[model samples]
Target: MQDGSDWYGAATATFGDRVAGAREALGMTQPELAERLGVRIKTVRGWENDTAEPRANKLQMLSGILGVSLTWLLNGEGDGLDQPAGEAGARLPEIRTLLSELRDIRADVDNAAERLARMENRLIEALTEGRVE
Candidate 1:
């Protein structure tokens, strides 16, 4: 950290940030990673969104699958992907903002889907009860 070469250093990147970066660097989608790690897609989503984390066994498997050290994924202090250079590096913050926005949208979609399921169940009950006109 002295030379400041690590863009996603321990001070800046969270566990989720490192996990997402490593996954993206390997060209893997959340579903793909989740399947490989034998977890649900939402589990992967939760990990990336910082809403949840994996267990120790899953963490080890994740590091192997993503080609990053467990230490780096945990603290961004070991062997890990380098941040893009020059122009790309300049856009890193912008990229992060967009990713944040996308994650928000994903949450909205999940919420909406859950609401739809509840509504559908209610409608089914209403029909069975002869409440609908």
Candidate 2:
């Protein structure tokens, strides 16, 4: 935001440029994104040109839908937003280990849910057949 550029304007330009770059990298056209966002092609072009700003909800949706990070859009920092360093390196092996554990826990929860559903069906069948004992 230095060099006499308006801070807000600079921010908008950064966001818009990154948005367009990310979209192009993903091989999406303005019309394609407009369809995904339920916006007009003009609206998408306005965002790319910094002519207009998106609402807060749209911004969040854009981040998710574009597969980038809000921080990357606003500040142009990190590895293309939502991708911080040390996420997959030995420097943060503990964090990676913890992430693996979390995934395992999630899998366990899914397995438990499936087992519970099967158990419920068995219980219902037993009750319907008067085999409660």
Candidate 3:
């Protein structure tokens, strides 16, 4: 049987920092997550502060609710908060190509955001008094 300390270790090792980080990453507060899990806010706080450990069933529920793999939630491997080890014999060219494409898309999105920001600023200035130079 898994002891409380074991559960605590797994939660800390997998989550690092604190369970709050994982909860926050999923855009949930203690009350919000507690509602989702049908638990009390204090239970969530205990998990975050390491004041108590979750049972196995709760851990599994948390893994699913938090949108992380069970293995990752337990072991902190395979796309956990940290990056996993590279697959063996993976070609560097493929990674480079994907990275280049991602960068190009990011640049396009950034340009669009900048243009939107400028337009919004101009609109605000026009409403306030004069055109934004």
Instruction: Name the candidate that leads on lDDT.
Output: 1
Candidate 2 yields a Cα-based lDDT of: 0.64
Question: Which tens-of-lDDT digit does each residue in 1-133 have in candidate 1?
Answer: 1222256677766788788888888899999999999999989988987778899999999989988887888888777878767886778778768877887887788778889999999999988999655
Better of 2 and 3 by TM-score: 2
Q: What's the residue-level lDDT of 46 in candidate 3?
A: 59
> Which window of ten consecutive residues has the lowest lDDT sum in model 2?
1-10
| Predictions in order: lDDT | 0.81, 0.64, 0.58
Give TM per candidate. Answer: 0.78, 0.50, 0.46
Candidate 2 vs. true structure, TM-score: 0.50
**Model 3 lDDT per residue over 16-130, tens place:** 2225546776788779988988898767755654446788988888877876565655555443343223651245346545544654565566567779999999998788886
Candidate 2, residue 95: the lDDT equals 53
Q: Which parts of model 1 are misplaced by more than 4 Å? A: 1-5, 125-133
Give per-residue lDDT, candidate 3, residue 124: 88
Off by over 4 Å in 3: 1-18, 82-133
For residue 92, model 2's alpha carbon misses the true position, in angstroms, by 32
lDDT (Cα, tens digit) per residue for candidate 2, span 1-133 = 1121221123323566677767876899989998998898777866776557898888888878877667666667533522223533333446545644654565566567779999999999888899654
Q: Which candidate number maximizes TM-score? A: 1
* Deviation (Å) of 114 in candidate 3: 50
Q: What lDDT is obtained when candidate 1 is compared to the true structure?
A: 0.81
